[model samples]
Target: MMNFTNQISTATDPAKIVDELAQGKAEDYNIGFLFVSGLSNTAMAEVIALLRKRLKVDHLLGCTCAGIIGSEAEIERLPASTLILGKLPGVKILPFSLNQTQFDDFQQVDDWLQFFNVFPNENPKFLILPDPFLFDMHEFLSGLNQVYPGCPVIGGLASGAMQPRENLLFINNESFEEGIVGVALVGNFSVSTIVSQGCRPIGQSYIVTRAENNIIYTLAGRPFIQVLEEVLQKATARDRLLAQEAIFLGIAMDEYTHNFKRGDFLIRTVIALDQSTGAGVITDYAKAGQTVQFHVRDAETATEDLNELLLSHRKKEQNKKPLGALVFSCNGRGENLFREKNHDISIIQKCVGPVPAAGFFCAGEIGPVGGSNFLHGFTNSIALFYPEEETAA
Candidate 1:
């Protein structure tokens, strides 16, 4: 069995926030997940030190963020919050910290497995928080894919720091300015992942006929610009306006599927277009012979996308409630994109039925898309935790 509780305090005083968090937490918890935001720069260390002494969990991991989400509120830039999950009776939680130098040491799958003392059959899930400025998560995640295959790794990149070594990452009681902090959970639970890029498919899907590196020159044997013109002509006035502000291209991650929808594609930003050359540049590499579609993003589309995904997942769960959830949303979302307070967390509460949830605004969110994990911006990555008995049913 698993027990979880989340606490959020608006107090600017670090000690006061800690006091509120420790008020009624059980003493038998094996692990604690903590997130802090809006506290003064001078108070980060003190707050962390106090939580370590007060919470007294066997293992603790978390990081500072631009904002913190706890309960049903998306508290941005003015609150300190912590979510604690009590002891899992049959679980093994191992907390680890790594820098760029240390990540380079584990060069092989056997090396990783041996280091973590985990076999491939253990099916562990990772909760990680890395500084976006220092670590190359793309390379790290790619390696993990080779080693762990389908293991779920969920968390967000630390936010609120302007430059290198400015962000705070925590493992146990220690804090670091440059590195990653996380834990490996190797027993008695499962985490279901939801990664919403928050965009809606706008135009019909097209097959790429010609492309050079990251540039797409032709789609369905026509110039890429021609395809864009045709799409814009058919789009609604509202969609056209959204396209002008933020248009993206979704490359089909699985070409085997005959029908493509919103979640079927790996969305990439349309960075630039050349009218004369009839070519386009995207943030992600596009290869010839891949299926692609245009997508438009706005507040309305984002809300619909999240609500649909959450509802679909709940339907598939057959009415079993999740124990808790960890949400990693891009800093660009929340009030900045939604223009409303408590947007993402509020939706989760309504759709996922008010399970205890905690998270932070990330510089880049991490979760799987198309059966592979990628670092994403402007995406909301959620991990829903459930016990063995819950999922077995």
Candidate 2:
């Protein structure tokens, strides 16, 4: 059987926070995740020590963030901490940490297997937290894809720090301000991932006819800017107004997919446009023959996108309700973008039936889209955990 408990405390003192978290009936939790926000390094360390002594969990992993999410609410820019303890029977929890040097040294599939002491056949799913300033997340994710092939990798970049060594990562009794800390879960558990980029298509999809790297010269044999203007002319008043500052480009992940729609393409920010050359530059690369579309984002679109994805997940997994979830939402979200507190976590609980959930607002969220994991911004990435047998049902 699998069980999870989630708790949150807003007490200013570390001992008070730990005391509040330790109030519930103690279970033999095999794994625990702790997310802290607005806490000093000294206080965070003390809280970790107290939790270790109080909970006595064998495996513990987590990090600091700008905001913390719990089962009931989300606290942003406040001195808060949330803990999630799980009793996962028949699950193999392998916790590991990688320094910058070790991360750079890994070059092959065997290197990863040897370092993690696990095989690809184990079908492990990963939950990772890496310091944004110190690690090359793109390279690390690419290596995991090459090594694990279709395995799901979920989590986020540690936030709430302006520089390196400011954000803390926790693994068991140790903590670090740099590098990456994560765990690999193998056996008797299943994870379903949802990655909502929080943008809706604004114009008809068009094929890229000319492009170089991240710059697009033409779409459907017309200047990219011209196509963009035409799309804007045809858009609604609200959409046109949003396109001024909220415009983005979506690149279809699968070329073979004929009809592209919402969630079909990878959303990337439109960084700049060269009107003189009638070209546009996006955050990601574009190539000829690729499908592209203009997208716009706002509070309404973000809420709708998240709701649609969550409802779809619930419908698909009707037989096996998730027991818990780990959410990684972009720091750009929360009350800043939604104009209200607890928007993401509240919607999650409403859709997922209030399952034990915990996470933090991340610098960048990580999850799979189109069978490939990519780092995303202005997004919400979630990992839903359930029994393995339920996955087969």
Candidate 3:
């Protein structure tokens, strides 16, 4: 079994931050994680070079992001960079790149595993940094589910670019423009995923009685519009006002669950309403017989939901602390949604007691919900790392 050691940084001066971190006692470290905002694009080449020289790790993975998260702060729309250095004793890390052509040629898990020299029994966890522009993420995630069942693929889509091929991904000291760059961690570690979609259910759960593709015509034997109207009428004044723009629909991924709680549902945006037919349009496919509920998102609910989830994780783990965390938050969060600046990361630190963490504001986040991975918007997907076999001590 191996112990975990890490350090996190958010500094404006790339060279100075790298220099400070390079001075740390990191001789046993095998992996380096980095995320930076576009403000440092002018000097990214130098940044990567310095990281490679200083970290001296077997794997170096990162990307340019809309914002950088580190320690207890989420730095948004600013020039910032975050780095996490880890010493994974007995862990095997394999880094790879995927492009449009490789996606087509990709057929089986063996094709991916051979490059990493890993077997399915190794139980690898993936850290994905995908370019939202070129990758058909839905299809890619679906394929991974079928090929590598029960493995956690956690990460965020690279943001900070408005158009295709504008974002950058880093593997080792090299940078790429149009592909996915990620690493597979196999052996002697445990990874737990926490995906907070940032919504709480407003009304009782209902079964989708009628639906077509992404449109929901009815719920629990009534028109969708009628159900929504009832929910709205019952909502408090503040919730009603928030419902006007911030309302969402939570599709229960496990329909059999008797009580659908906060994390049980996969939250999707309520895009539009068809008054003529009393149907509701959702961002994802809605099928008959699935459980559904209306959800609302405001600063208060978002804050409470995040805090509750983090506290629950703490209770489950009891006295054991996590080594670090990687947070993939939505671009819609931050001051745009909360009145405060360090809202999400601050709450995480409050519950977990300030673990070494780093991440970015993603255009779309990727994590498992109801035992499967999906591309989600307006979510805070976090992965907590644990040392190997801690109970034996």
Instruction: State every prediction's TM-score relative to the real structure.
Output: 0.95, 0.96, 0.92
Candidate 3 — which residues are off by over 4 angstroms?
Answer: 1-14, 40-42, 108-117, 389-393
Q: What is the C-alpha lDDT of each candidate?
A: 0.83, 0.88, 0.82
Give the number of the best model, judged by TM-score: 2
lDDT score, candidate 2, position 41 = 83
Better of 1 and 3 by TM-score: 1
Candidate order by decreasing lDDT:
2, 1, 3
Model 3 lDDT, residue 71, Cα: 69
- Expressed as tens digits, the lDDT of each residue in 1-393 for candidate 3 is 333344445565778767765666557568777887855455776778877876667788888889888866788888777777777777778888888788887777777666556665677888899998977888888887776677788999998788887788889867888789998888777887888888888878999999999999999889899999999999889889889986799989888899778789999998999999999999998899999889998878888888988898888888577787888999998888897888888888888866888889999999998878889998899988888644210
Cα RMSD (angstroms) for every candidate in the order listed: 2.0, 1.6, 2.6
Worst 10-residue lDDT window for candidate 2 reads: 384-393
lDDT per residue (tens digit) for residues 1-393 in model 1 = 686777877777878878888888746788778888876556877877887788758887887789998878888867566665565768898788889988888877887887667776788787889999878798888887778877777889999687998888888767888888888888878788888999988879999998988899999999998899899999999989998897899988898888877579888898999999999898877888899999988888889999999898899898678888889999999999989999998899999867988889999998888867778889999988788734421
